[model samples]
Target: MSEVPTTRPARGRPRDPGIDARVLPAAVAELAEKGVSGFSTRAVAARAGVDRRGVHARWATSEDLVVDALATLTANLRPPLTGTLRGDLDDLVPDVARALSGQRRRVLQRCLDEVGDAPAITERFRRDHVDRCTAVLEDAFHRAAGRGELVAATTPARATEVLMGSLLLRALTVGDDAVRGDALDGVVDHVVALVSTSAPGARS
Candidate 1:
């Protein structure tokens, strides 16, 4: 008679759900403080008060970790709906300006530098950021159309690119100072006017 194979308990302890909470924030802090150069599993683990294995258990590489951390940082940056698209965009301008400035600016620059080496990470970042912004703009446009505040010809993708592109350009060129005071308001007003005019039956 064949002997029955013995079953053994799984190796290693069960994964802690709390590990992610600790790891991600630590990763963000690391990126914020050290940028991409200092972003490593070992460093993040130390910051999070866990073993390096804990970070590896969650992310395959530093690029993966960075993407997730950046995603978390920008997760709440979506524009709020204030009934009208203009109002929604106006409300979001200050936050957008803030994001493009300060520590976030350094974080973004580091990510951009790393993108050449990590195409996958770049794609993930674009999806998390650009795609999300496009979706938010699309929803805003839809709402505006329903309210007869926008034209059927308006395209969210184009509009999102315009808005994001302008912010990025300003951030890169004139730095944070250009995005403050009346400058930030001016950008918002310009974007709103352009979007409004792009609607049907509106003056160019």
Candidate 2:
């Protein structure tokens, strides 16, 4: 994988890279500033100080740019499998909550609020982001079950949905002020109680 540059050249500083380094960062900055409604190729190009034609040449549509940006947004969130379900949740849950806490939530909320107006954008957001997140979080429970950390199979799916729903709601409504220690912790304690073995960390 080609390294993504961590910092953009100063505005109008003349970068000669593939513009990937320039545009993706610019897209995120643009998203944070404008939400989804105001996001456009022209706007992102201006933000990156690159020609709009180059952006269009790279990402044929705004949806493409947004999807690529979404990919980078969660690129660092690798799941933790420490053999104990509670341990895994303790680590994974907070990281995910923090990811949802700031501009990430803005991306989702904006796409969600005007889903009909931008159906393609919204669908891409869900497919690229929401659904991908659900898959990772839901898998943690199954891993726990396989390791005999769950007593009764009380349906991890419902608990997973509840966990995700609560987090999304909290992030959208409450924002970062509600986040604590990188763990927004929406229904997390309840979900843990519902799915954990009687011994908490015991394995069969």
Clashes of each: 0, 0
**Could you give candidate 2's per-residue lDDT for residues 97-201 as a string of tens digits?**
766767766766665666787778778777876677777777888887777667675556765786777776777787776655535453567677766785566
Which candidate tops lDDT? 1
> lDDT (CA) for every model shown?
0.75, 0.73
**Best by TM-score, which number?**
2
What's the alpha carbon RMSD for model 1?
4.6
RMSD of each: 4.6, 8.2
Worst 10 residues of 1 by lDDT: 195-204
Model 2 score (lDDT):
0.73
In candidate 2, the residue pairs with backbone N, CA or C atoms under 3 Å apart (3 or more residues apart, or in different chains) clash, namely: none
Instruction: Give the CA lDDT, 0 to 100, for residue 60 in model 2.
Output: 90
